[model samples]
Target: MEKLLQTVRITINDKLYVKDPESSDLGKRIIRESIKMIYEIGFESFTFKKLGTRIGSNESSIYRYFENKHKLLLYLASWYWGWLEYQLVFATNSIPDARLKLQSAIEIMTQPTEIDTAFTHIDEVMLNKIVINEYSKSYLTKEVDQENKEGYFVIYKRLVNRMSTMIKEVKPSYPYPSSLASCLLEGALHQYFLMDHFNSLTDCSIKNTPTAYFKHLVFNALND
Candidate 1:
């Protein structure tokens, strides 16, 4: 509960929601229960009616916070990325060795996540599951470009930018820092997902864990 011990509010784009879920009890409940319900039954099978029933609120109450279930999902996914960026910065900011910093960033991004207690309204563990399974759908849509233009992907991009900067510091001559950063992020998520549904597509065994493998790949590529 270290996170809940202090008040930490991770902000998302105001345009992403009809109301800010952090501002009031009902709004927070909408965020909290929606994450649980969505993670339980997949986003496609989730809706305001079910969410309302779970939390004793109505669809209109839920709509007051989010335009629809998709927006709610975006809010959850965006909050996770934002939280991850904070963790990456906090973990790497003090490491004087650029290589060590990069390794720590890899661990933060790739290794399985534990629930963070700072934001009591959020179950970081379940949210991580949702992200691992459904995050790409948030942007793999026809409106991706429009959402990007509207700043919906700012947190995720900022995360990539931060990690890319770390990569550059480790290898100023490296040409594909951004590409590598994104691959590291998306690649790790893919491995996590595939480990569940298509085990052959990934090798996350303890012998060559995903975090360790990414570290090896990154360091070998940079060769710094």
Candidate 2:
């Protein structure tokens, strides 16, 4: 009995060591690699087979981690949302003054990370198609039921709420509504990046560096 227990303990320790040199490393690697592939190929063109090949794993192995492609996409989107939350929290942390917090929040929204530019034009085309198709299907399926509405809201609305809260904190006499502020911010970004009119309006120069234009818009909006 004593020999059996010793052998079992040794086997467990060996398994643990082999499985993770540090905890959560394997999962992090999976996510990181998955994001890289998704950004390169876009979600529509990105297959689990390709992802598995890139990550040096089998399709079955990825399936063990994620039930399906849709689930994997959701996971990626959720991870992005979490990243946005972290940025917001970090930006607001040092700004005890509400105005500064608001400025930082706008800055966070306008500034695209290095990860953003890693995607090629082809990647953007494929990804936009995939997202639009998914969203259309979800709308048709009435997937925007009450519970899921909150989830959608959290994706973008929460950022607006944070900004609104900051505005209220800074200028108690002139409080901004969260919904209105969110609409303006979303409109500005969507108009600049996704709208066709932007090309003709800005002589194509602003299109080259949309992030900078986005930051300018945010600053202008705040000043207005």
Candidate 3:
């Protein structure tokens, strides 16, 4: 029989939640089920009341972990970017070539996700779907400026900074490392989103074995 995976704690910005969900079984359930529900029914239709029903917990319990559904969304997105950063570091750790490191990062960013066993309660692959489709909603709101001031986006910025550094290493004089890196992150997401919703907006076939169009776009920009 396969051994049960050990629980893994994923830390996010404390500012995103009223309580630490990974600290208890109930909290973990809240995060795990919330991701699944958000992916099932987009954020607009997701509610703590519904999540409460699915998890067999009361809505107040869910609220204790997160102030509202919006905060929960931010928490989920932060965890994903942090997780992606971890993937990028692990994939590029042994690579010495700057270009190869950047390429690895791009591949991880665009590739379809598989469940990460570390966080057993959360379905990372489905969480990734939520990230791709609902990520923009995390920050595009009236309170974005306040959230930004509170470092709500640090994890995302750090991931972008990591890639920006790699791009700079490849072309030291490149004046747009950050811009190029952010474009690769946001552009790939938008492409995937388009492929899922408005098929006409993007020609990228995410189902294809090799997710290379993103690499093609980024490498060309860097090569120019």
Candidate number of the best TM-score: 1
lDDT order of candidates, top first: 1, 3, 2
lDDT of 2 by residue, 96-122 (tens): 876667667766655434333322211
What lDDT tens digits, residue by residue, belong to model 1 across residues 1-224?
A: 46444765677999989888888999988888888988899989998999899999778988888887777778888999999988887778899999889889999999888878677788998999999999988999999999899999999999999999999999999999999999999998888888878988777765678998898889999995
- Each candidate's TM vs. the true structure? 0.95, 0.60, 0.93
CA lDDT, every model vs. true structure: 0.88, 0.51, 0.85
TM-score, model 2 to reference: 0.60
Off by over 4 Å in 3: 1-8, 207-210
Predictions: Cα RMSD each: 1.7, 11.3, 2.6
What number of clashing residue pairs does each candidate have, in the order they appear?
Answer: 4, 0, 0
Distance (Å) between predicted and true CA of 78, model 1? 0.6
Model 2 Cα shift for residue 83 (angstroms):
1.9
CA lDDT, candidate 1, residue 183: 98
Q: Weakest 10 consecutive residues, lDDT, candidate 2?
A: 9-18
